[model samples]
Target: MDPGSKLPLSPHIQIYRLPLTALLSVVHRATGVALALGAVLLVWILALAANSAEAYGQLYPHLASWYGQIFLLGLIFSLYLHFCNGIRHLFWDIGMGFDLEIVHRTAKFAIFAAIVLTVATWAIAANLEL
Candidate 1:
């Protein structure tokens, strides 16, 4: 091979079928990014809450809108997923739940827990009129 020439690269998921783990890995990172952004938003919310009622009033209406609610809901789900998966990773780091069956079961459990937590959060928020 010429020094300037690159070796042929094997085709990836775009050409071959990708596995669940591959897709889950991508989603995990994506959710992490979403959670980071959500954390920034959470800080803003806290700042607003700490400020005067007038300041919160100014921000609240925007946050109460449909678009804002949707964004918040997305953030909530992302945070839940990231949190659950983070715990799963901690368990893996401790040398537990590494078996193929256990890994699959844990992945499924994390997903279910995330959904449940997200929905429960929304329910409480609605009940509190927040």
Candidate 2:
């Protein structure tokens, strides 16, 4: 409380880099939110299909455009990442994989698995179209 003495200041984000687990934790929450938002897109697509062919036709062109493809890809990746991270959390809920090393390994695996699953889903869908 003395004006003459300065208290130790906590490290700012610029000064302190987050650990991998901490960064992944943040991404996990972000992806969760992204997936929730993506559900709205899903509903819109379904509603368009249910209404009429003309209504669905209106949506198809936008979805087939490059920007729309990019948005769809991001949404797909977010869905996989959120699903993978949720499984990681389920293990934690059961008091498993608590070791620091195990935690780090699983964090890496979750990200890797999500990327793999996302790519595989796209590849399979593409093949189906052919």
Candidate 3:
């Protein structure tokens, strides 16, 4: 190795394309973070509810707003995605679904199932009144 030679660099982001499993792994970590933030928000809401009915009343409208509904939907999707991927990981831990084809198939299935579950959840929630 020449001391004056430039070090080799990894491929640029624009040139690198992640496979489905790799992308799912990244999404899993992101959703984990999102879920943590959602937990904090949940705690704050619970605290408000416990404090006074007035405080809860003040917060309810905003939460029921269109933008708030969108944020909640994203949170719900994140939860399902994280959950489905976690189960996939559990299966892998148990010495199953190790083949490359099986791995990709499960990754796709987990995503598809998560989407369906998220939609079903929101649909059911939309029908119930407080």
lDDT of all the models against the reference? Answer: 0.85, 0.90, 0.95
Ranking by lDDT: 3, 2, 1
Candidate 3 lDDT (Cα, whole model)?
0.95
As for model 3, its CA RMSD to the true structure in angstroms is 2.8
Which candidate number has the best TM-score?
2
Task: Indicate the residue-level lDDT of 98 in model 1.
Answer: 89
- Each prediction's TM-score versus the true structure: 0.82, 0.90, 0.89
The positional error of residue 46 in candidate 2, measured at the CA in angstroms, is: 1.0
Give one digit per residue, the lDDT tens place, for model 1 in 60-98: 888899998998898889889888888989998999998
Q: Regarding lDDT, does 1 or 3 come out ahead?
A: 3
In terms of TM-score, how similar is model 3 to the real structure? 0.89
Error of 2 at 104 (Å): 0.6
lDDT of 1 at 63: 81
Runs of candidate 2 exceeding 4 Å displacement: 1-8
lDDT of 3 by residue, 24-112 (tens): 99999999999999999999999999999999999899889999999999999999999999999999999999999999999999999
Pairs with backbone N, CA or C atoms under 3 Å apart (clashes), candidate 2: none
